[model samples]
Target: MPAATRHLARRFGASQIALNTKMTIETIYIARHVDIYASSAGYRMNWVTDDWQSVTGLPRDPPLAEYGLSQAQELADYFLSLPEEERPTIMLSSPYYRCLQTAVPTAQKLGLPLYVEHGLSEWYSPVAPGTGLHPRPASAAELRTYFPEIDESWQSIYYPSRKGEDVEQVHDRANGFLRALIPYIEHKFGGKHKRVLLVSHAATVIALTHELIGDRNLPLRVGCCTLTELQRKPGETELIGAWERKRLADGSHLKDGATREWGLEDIIVINDTGLPGTENAADSPVGLQVDLLPPEVLAHV
Candidate 1:
């Protein structure tokens, strides 16, 4: 949903946000989509208990598998390589095995507990029973067949398909879940500042941030694992709905000098900006005023 225009007035506070030098504490939410599953796994969107296990094969519930353990370590290595200051306060995942698995190493790197917020969960696209790599049983009798624990999970409250946790449920849960952290973010950034990091899906991030910043015109252009940083003025409202009108990357509109084009910047924004942040906005002057270093420039730093 787009944010209300009425909220636009709150974007710039009484003071001129276009100018200010406030150091803000940041929360880096890594939107991870590290490839864990093989491509042949087929479509498994709204996969249920049996389906999830078939693809991920018994998630590492405490005692985790050796393969899973190794994957976590590798992921942690990647995270540790990053500047220590960018470490996230809350390490979260989309409640998926792969995501949780990815976070295992991240949590280790950050030395923080993994907090499961339903808002960070993945969107449901309804995986057909047999279409999955698990290949749903030909009959109900066969489908019903499963280990006792798997059977128990069918009725588990945390399962994704249990009435209240559908696709729509995910969107709603995400909105509500992220709302809880707004104040914490405000405090972290010292009042209406911005932060950076990663995110997974495109929809939920757009929905949540749009509502948060109240930008109905927002055209979110965020992609997976691509590093992006946002900085806001102290009095200006936090980063929220602008998905429609602007581009998030610093070089979104790079001219015809083919080689000077914006690379890996949002892969391709959901909107014209090709990014949800400043890289693609009319606010380029303002964005550059604050973000002295373009992403390409920062890579070497």
Candidate 2:
């Protein structure tokens, strides 16, 4: 089949059918990691954060950057890549200066109003000046010590650990946003753009992915400016997933001696068509036959 035909079939529609596992998802979550920094040789600064362990359970500190305005500018530039109408979809951010600063670029990118939502903000950190989150190393191991690939960092960002909600809680939160936003996008811009870019912190991004695709340990590292493209089948009752990721150029993790690469398998959507005890038709697109990625086979290098 020709490339164009195949691509069309990958997206869900009343008549469209995904041809293979290499399906094209319709949604993309373009996440922005906070605390942008520049490495010694002009590499993008990443991993540095305003969330010191005191408030955040992270093991390491975010990189120190001259400022995050430039990073935000770049985000805006990407949005500007789209026509004015396309950028009006959805642009949400945290209340924090860094997060708001981070979102400015995307807001600029889409020319959409930045609707700040405290619900989607980073995890809560009770570690007061006198108190602290256990001094820990800023590595995957430390993060995993809490729960496999799942950690408090994600919990705090998504749920705030305030009153209720568990793994399912955050999933519902993300799902709620998606359910409402999907219609909003279609109404505002029609089909020109169904893509919704969420400019948020790292843990929040990872957690949101976990919500859509049923994998808590998904190896998705939403570093500074990492774009996760998810193409959902149109009119399909389920989320048939497809995507890929690369390190953000000039992002901070590269400067921290971090050696990483895409483990292609990590890019996949969970097949949640009729799974028991999960989000049903009411909450999600019902009867949606999603081509999913098994969590075990999904990993990143």
Candidate 3:
């Protein structure tokens, strides 16, 4: 066993003798990919316009724009600022160029292996038949060449396509990803809190939240570089499956408390989506509040 696993095993042995049961607390953090912009084509709804053929007339997989790269750098800094133990031990990212780009700086800074997961890719949108608006991700070989640190040992199950997935499918995909972690969690750090970081698209992360909590009552839409955390114990009953929501679509860490810097902007507003202020207008400036609720409130949810 590796040094870290050996240490965890020794600790787990002692804890097992005292408690006589596995605790298996694993914390998962999901972050949405940061800002991306069109090269020559204009964007729509924050994504590169699907009909690039009409505008730029060039096939493109949009990478992070300059602003997006800055946001990602800020995000990396946020994670770097955390205590060593508080940072994630493992990092998984969507195979998309943008998601991989988002994870690259953090992986480089933290010395963590980056895993490309196809299930974490952006929600696909099926275009009209023969319109050729269907977007596809770059090949793994291309990604590997670009991101030399990526773990090429793992195989991706998602193939690039224009077909879009519904909310339920996204939820199922998230569940699959989560469920597959149980064995690794048990073996790597039994009964200890090990943070796993996932860099994915907005819809996939939101669906993950729903899967973990069994509720669609998310506080707001997930935005670029937003972070949400959830925790649970392995082999625990679903009835007592507790999770904590630390942050929701928050980029405040990018700016000083008093002044918004780092090119922070409120592009999407959360309202009438069963959040606390349902009556608030969709364009309300107050924007989506991160759920920094007390532990008791999180436990109840």
Candidate 4:
């Protein structure tokens, strides 16, 4: 056994004997990828008038915008500023170009290999019959050319379907990945007491959060480069322990707070339809209230 494993084994033995000591805890941090240069037509950044095909050649994979580069740096700095013990020992990122780009700086700073996990990849929304082809993210070998920090030896726990997944399917994917991932981490690191950082897309972030907390109805805020922290104590017989959300899509570390925040409602609509913000405006009471009030009354109220 490795030195860390031997040491952890001794500690576990001691804890078992005592029966009252606290078990080790693990911390998981999920971060959304920085702003993409472009996405689907309605979801593209304000300045990106060109289509994803025109800019990236790929249908849905666009590299981060210039400002996103700066945001990545800020994320790196934030991680670096954390105390040594609080820092993540392992880092994982989606195989997508944008996610890989977002994780590179932090991986370099921490001197950790970036593991490309397909399970953490962006949500695959269904492609309309004539709209276009579903995006196939670059393979690990292809991505290595751009990000040398990628750990080619590491394999993903699970891969997302190309056909696309509904909200519930994505949630199940996240849960399944977590079930396998916890054991993998324990074996690789010699214990479940590890800090892990995962960088993925907005939809994947929400899915992961929902799985971790065991709640889908709670409003989740996922924004560009936002961080969500989850922690759990070691469970005796369970592959995974009960997790608690310490932070919810927090972007306080960034100079500019969360931008382009998205929620479960937004993703569901986007997945069902190619367009974003398609919900009927009349359904909202705020809009109806404004329309019902006179101009003078609305101005003051």
RMSD vs true structure, all candidates: 16.3, 14.8, 13.7, 15.9
Instruction: Report the C-alpha lDDT of model 2 over 1-301, residue by residue, as the tens digit.
Output: 4443444445434143322233122566556544545542333234444444322333332432554455556556655776754443655554444565566656654545555444455532223222222222223234334223122222121223222233444555665444434433343344455456666655556666665554655665555555554545445543312233322222432223222222223433332122233222232211111122111111100
Best of the two (1, 2) by lDDT: 2
Off by over 4 Å in 3: 1-25, 36-60, 126-139, 157-162, 182-193, 233-242, 256-301
Off by over 4 Å in 2: 1-26, 38-65, 82-88, 125-169, 180-193, 239-301
lDDT of 1 by residue, 161-219 (tens): 21123334444544444433443334333554333343334455544444544553455
- Judged by lDDT against the true structure, how good is candidate 1? 0.35
Question: Would you list the clashing residue pairs of candidate 3?
Answer: none
Identify the candidate with maximal lDDT: 4
Tell me the tens digit of each residue's lDDT in model 3 across 129-212. 333333445545657877897987655533333434445555555665554343334444444546788898777777677776
Global lDDT scores for all candidate models? 0.35, 0.42, 0.57, 0.69
Largest TM-score belongs to which candidate?
4
lDDT of 4 by residue, 217-261 (tens): 668879888999988744633323367889989989877778778
lDDT of 4: 0.69
